[model samples]
Target: MSDSSINLDELRQRIDQLDGDILRLISERAACAQKVAHVKLAHDKDAVFYRPEREAQVLRRIMSLNEGPLDSEEMARLFREIMSACLALEQPIKVAYLGPEGTFTQQAALKHFGESAISLPMAAIDEVFREVEAGAVNYGVVPVENSTEGVVNHTLDTFMDSSIHICGEVVLRIHHHLLISDTTRRDKISRIYSHPQSFGQCRKWLDAHYPHAERVPVSSNAEAAKLVKTEWHSAAIAGDMAAKLYGLERVADKIEDRPDNSTRFLIIGSHQVPMAGEDKTSIVVAMRNQPGALHDLLEPFHRHKIDLTRIETRPSRTGVWNYVFFIDFKGHVDEPRVAAVLDEVRLRASELRVLGSYPQGVL
Candidate 1:
């Protein structure tokens, strides 16, 4: 046999052996998870099997211990699926995301929970929150902010009234593509359809290229992609998921004006997550109308040397004179310094609510 043929045969044999080892190890892990479920049931029938803090720790440890040709994130993502499958064996869970099945929110949900999870599509952001609150789903994923377009006000507003906690977070890098189905006429494209947020994200590109095309704002990019599938003279601006779902060709890829346009999504659940080394806490503070109310609310954070990631102001719904400030910081609420800061802020504000402290997005 040729030396090259011998090398190829040896390499394929090694890979097959490795695959067999991986399969056995994964089966052992799933069996252990099933035993854990039985133990929890014996201890308490209502015990929650899905623990976000534990999942975060496992992923972080995998990333830290990885010494591979594959990058850290890529390696972590592979383990994510394994953990997801094991968790399903422990107890299968359902997650809800903003709808039509092809949106970026759905991608985020799948990214966080893995493919083994049952992900349902909700019609709106509020509905995602409602499903979680109503116990119809185990968790919900909703967009909180975008790098290009800023915060999602509807999502922020929904948090103001809901009792649900942010158990985790997932950040998805967005790439908008100009899509056309087989029926679409590339030369005669006259109308462009997309969600208003997507249109805003791709405003510069649209203005420069399709200046004359009638722009229609639909409920979602997925819906727009669906619409263009049946129209011969129309095109849609959406992501790869939508294109793949609707079987559309990408005429223009990465049409977003910014190369790094991304959105941060929050995982909403009923339980508060325990500390997982790296964490972020979100809170809403309602302040009475006064000259130094804002300053007073922020001073505690500055004094405690807590790193504030983001702060957004929303008009209070209860009273015109009151202003609500949504604050995100880089520590868990259980920490001493974070607790001190919250106490001081509570004394200074009319009302305070700690949304949740969850592990920072690892994968």
Candidate 2:
């Protein structure tokens, strides 16, 4: 045999041996996870099988320890799947996300929780909250904000009325594509369908290419993709998940105006997550409708040097011209400095509710 062929054969044999070792180790890990479930169940009948903080820590550690041809994130993602599978052996988790099965929120849910999770789709953001609030699902995922389109006000408004807590968060980079079905007449495409935000993201691209095409706003990009499947003269602007789900072909890929377009999704649940070293806390503050109310609200955070990640204002339902502020900042509430800041802010604001203090996104 040639030297190159012999080398390739030896490499293949080494890989096969490594695969066997990996399989055995994974089995051992699964057995250990099963034992953990038994121990927890033995002590507490209703013990929670999933720990967001713990999972976050593991993924973060895996990323930190990785030194290979594969990047840290890619390595962490592999570990995340392994952890998810082992957790399923302990107890399967149910998650709800805003969807008709193929939206970005669904993608975010799958990214945050692995494929082992049972994911349900809700028609509206409020419905996602309701599912988690009613205990129908273990957790819910909802889009909080987009890098280009700003905040998802519907999600913020739903949070105002719901008692659900934020468990964790995941950020997904969005890439909208112009998609068509097999029957679509490429040249005869007279209408385009997409969510309003998607149209905004891809406005420049559409204007430059298909300016004459009627831009039809729909409930979601998934719905747009679904509509295109039946329309011969229509195309949809949506993400890869929607296109794949509807079996549509991409006519134009990554047509979003900005290359850095992304969306942040929140994982909502009943339980408060413990600190995972690096953490972020979300709170909603209702200030008295008076001069310097906003100043009073933000002074504590600034004074404490707490890094604020996001701050958004929504009209309050209580009174005229009243506004509630949704604030996200670094540090867990269990810490002395963070607790001090919250205490000070509570004294100044009319109402302050800490939504959650969870580990920042690991992947």
What TM-score would every model get versus the actual structure? 0.98, 0.99
Q: Which stretches of candidate 1 lie over 4 Å from their true place?
A: none
Relative to the true structure, how large is the alpha-carbon lDDT of every model?
Answer: 0.93, 0.94
Candidate 1 has its poorest 10 consecutive residues by lDDT at 314-323
Candidate 1 per-residue lDDT, tens place, 1-363, comes to: 999999999999999999999999999999999999999999999899998889999989998998989988999999999989998888878999999889999999999999999999989999998999999999999999999999999999999889999999999999999999998889999999999989999999999999999999998899999999889999999998999998999999999999999999999999989999999999999987888998899988888899999999999999866679999999999999999999888888899999999999997
lDDT of 2 at 57: 92
Residue 95 CA displacement from its true place in model 1, Å:
0.5
What 10-residue stretch in candidate 2 is worst by lDDT? 60-69
Count clashing residue pairs in model 2: 0
The residue ranges of model 2 lying beyond 4 angstroms of the native Cα positions read none
User: Candidate 2, 216: how far from true, in Å?
Assistant: 1.2
Candidate 1 structure, TM-score to reference: 0.98
